[model samples]
Target: MRICFPVSQEKGWESPVFGHFGSAPAFVIVDTDSGQLEEVTNGDLHHAHGMCQPLKALGGRQVDGVAVGGIGMGALMKLQAQGITVYRAVEGTVKDNLAMLKEGKLPVFSSDWTCAGHGHAGGCAHR
Candidate 1:
């Protein structure tokens, strides 16, 4: 299974994921089966706030799930439509969150918000 994480900073995961999907920087694709990570750096082929051209660039890749700090309704819907589970407003670093996820300590999110990129604002647990 493959998972996607929208990150604010690079830890053990990546740095480019900190950028916007469409206008940010890049995305990190982790292969759970092999524990290999590939950074997709085509900023011109991604979308953040909503489904535009980037999501289309994803083609039919099946994303087992996703965890994003902040996002809007459009992107949320687009992901859902693609059969990709959407977890929103999640907090903590990518590694921290991944640990919690393994222990089933993290909860699946549904609210539309995060570290603020579009019109929404506020993210980070210390916030």
Candidate 2:
């Protein structure tokens, strides 16, 4: 499985996951089968609030799943429409979350978990 993780910077497998999906500065994609990692720049990093274009943010790359600490409802729905399953990530590195994912411990992100707004004092509080 190709699992995508939004990150503030590239730190290989040890990179910490960013708090929000749309506004992350970068993304790390891990190929579970071979443990290969690819870094992608967030193409839509400056999109207006509540108008995130998930595919654009991902630079048009296809991923089987996304592991994020938080996500907006619109972006979540857009990703789901593309058959991509979003997973709620723990407060840890990519390596840590990958382990839980392999063990079937990561939970699927539901609508109720979506961020209400990005105008909060410190960004998305859902994280």
TM-score of each: 0.64, 0.95
lDDT of 1: 0.52
Error of 1 at 31 (Å): 1.7
Per-residue CA lDDT of model 1 for 12-100, tens digit only, reads 46342332334434455567788876655434443433454536434444567766554455556667777777554244555555555
Q: Mark the regions of model 1 whose C-alpha exceeds 4 Å error after superposition.
A: 8-23, 42-54, 57-61, 89-91, 111-127
TM-score of candidate 2 on Cα atoms, chains taken together = 0.95
C-alpha lDDT (0 to 100) for residue 126 of candidate 1: 18
The residue pairs that clash in candidate 2, if any, are none
The true-versus-predicted C-alpha distance at residue 86 of model 1, in Å, is 1.3
Q: Write the per-residue lDDT of candidate 2 for residues 16-127, one digit (tens) a residue.
A: 9998999889999999998899999999999988899999998899899999999999999999999999999988999999999999999999999999876646578663
lDDT of 2 at 98: 94
Q: What is the C-alpha lDDT of each candidate?
A: 0.52, 0.92
Model 1: per-residue Cα lDDT at residue 73: 51
